[model samples]
Target: MTIERIRVLGLGKVGELVAHLLGGAGFEVAGGDLRPRPDLGFPVDVFDVGDPESLRSELDGFDAVVSCLPYDRNLGVAEAAAVAGLHYFDLTEDVPTTTRIRELAVGSDVVMAPQCGLAPGLVGIVGSSLADGLTDLRRMQLRVGALPQHPSGVLGYAFTWSPEGVINEYINDCEVIRDGHRQLVPAMADIETVVISGDRLEAFATSGGLGTLCETYDGRIRHLDYKTLRYPGHCDAIRFLLDELALRDRRELAGEILVNAKPPVDDDVVYLYAAVEGQGPDGLTRREYVRAWQPIEIAGRMWRAISWTTAASACGVVELVARGAVPGKGFLRQEDVSFDDLLSTPTGSLFRDEVAVA
Candidate 1:
């Protein structure tokens, strides 16, 4: 159960950080991408994701594989993990891709865990912890967002994470539990303003943020939803592109335009917020958790808020699984993890604090 080696798939913003974090955490980490990124200062192999033969071969020796690739490109890596008898983890928020991984994990000995980043990963863990005290849980709301430390663009946002994932979130229907039933809600349809510490931000429904919590809390909770937090006008501009400009059908082009227009920022802030309301032991109760994290220097390297948080989440889960803290079989959900256990790890402690998890 001791994980001495791990393979990280992809070497982009989050992937590179994952390699650094895992390496520093004393794991023999090898990063793989379609192209070589030697500057990462780790052993990186070149392999095309479309070529399953090469992927499975590249993944053969690792104890676990963490896919930081775009959500669309995760299945091949998951399959490669299955073929290699290694534990599988990914940061995908795509519901269909997750379903595919679940189907692939069935009857397999290796563990399969998806949605191991930010909203879908940490938020779900926090949600479960918060709901534990509620005698009759009525509602739960999860919101997360990463923005430039100093906002200047007309969109008031920067390229914090994957552009493809952002566009997919905008165009896809969000899954939520309402009236004690699962339903698909339109993304960006419900816009609400929230004020935290003098900064007023807006939140809107976004797809795949809920992970598997809807199914876990369906009949137990009356209402549950997840949304993305952004500056006041950010959602409106994205809605314009997807709805008015007819970019919904042309997601690739839309992603290119957005990525081309926005410059990536290393200095950024990530926002986390969760609200729970229900009848506790005494009476009707309500509690909320809020935290704003800034770019932090870790292990002698500086990383953006989004990069560190996203990578930490995936690494944290794999670390637990590698240490025999988590099961190594079938599909796993975010709600299956323990928040306290996650915080005790070196990687997950990046988000540990009274403010971060309060």
Candidate 2:
């Protein structure tokens, strides 16, 4: 279907920017949230997103709907989109939620794409692109971080993204491929140091970051893993909270406490690194792609690095689906998206303008 009128649910930081980018791309974008949002450059409605019937009613006459609500609320929105016969998209990293969406898309005609955020989204695309050029692929490592530019705390982090999502990834079991077999490992285990652009950061296994890559590359790649990058001592501090303090059992309180501690920051940086190792025509070799992205001006305003990057990646896929550059039917995997095609889109090309790290 040709996408024109698009409805965006949830008008938080990332959702607002997603609507902005989609509107800039020439799509008729309307947004919905719990409270009324004024002067968003598009029409917005205040309604109950939790009710599937209300959401389905709101989705009528729209060619597509983008859910930027919390991961838990996306399934209801996806079901509403299915009922409305409209294309569905979301930026969720919740495994169970994506699994249900996949089940919903089994025989559906509209496209259902989830986990269109940074690690699971763009990193998967980059890793797959690297693997496509190798003869004997041995391993693929993907890492990403969103941190304060000038950190001054024990955790050395700022809540650039959702606090609940961050806590979920930290406490859940991570999926990986080890020794050519799929396996489940504990989150925050197997910590390692990663050096990118002269910055020393620690990386550890995180759940939902791999998306469907473990299933896609199982037995094909010898070992495949994805990790979240943080400054030194961050993992230890988090372990103290989740393990030693026994806060893992009470995730809601834990999220509230952590968010109270390290709130969102305006000046932040996002670091991404992807490496592939395999046998080429000559011999064993490695290929890598690394970048440090900072906040920049977009549509006459400066946005957080994490905010724009996430919005750009999410909207880029939407633009591609609208143009038929990406598949318009059934489930859409982020790994299946072409990196070159993503970069060619108006919003996806934002990744090309990286900050020069010293």
Best by lDDT: 2
* TM match of model 2 to true structure: 0.98
For residue 168, what is the lDDT in candidate 1? 89
Deviation from native of the Cα of residue 129 in model 2, angstroms:
0.9
Q: After superposing candidate 1 on the true structure, give the runs of residues whose Cα lies further than 4 Å from its correct spot.
A: 353-358
Question: Which 10 consecutive positions of candidate 1 have the poorest summed lDDT?
Answer: 349-358
Estimate candidate 2's alpha-carbon lDDT, on a 0 to 1 scale.
0.90
Alpha carbon deviation, residue 192, candidate 1 (Å): 0.5
Clashing pairs in 2: none
**lDDT for each residue of candidate 1 in 1-358, tens digit (9 for 90 to 100):** 3578889888998999998888978899998888878677799898887898888788777888889999899987887787778888899999999998989889878789999999788889888878886877899999999988788866988887899999889888999989888999998988999776678889999999999999899789889999998999998898788889999899999999998888788889888898899998889998787888887888787888899888888888887887777776888888888878888788988777436432
**lDDT: worst 10-residue window of model 2:** 349-358
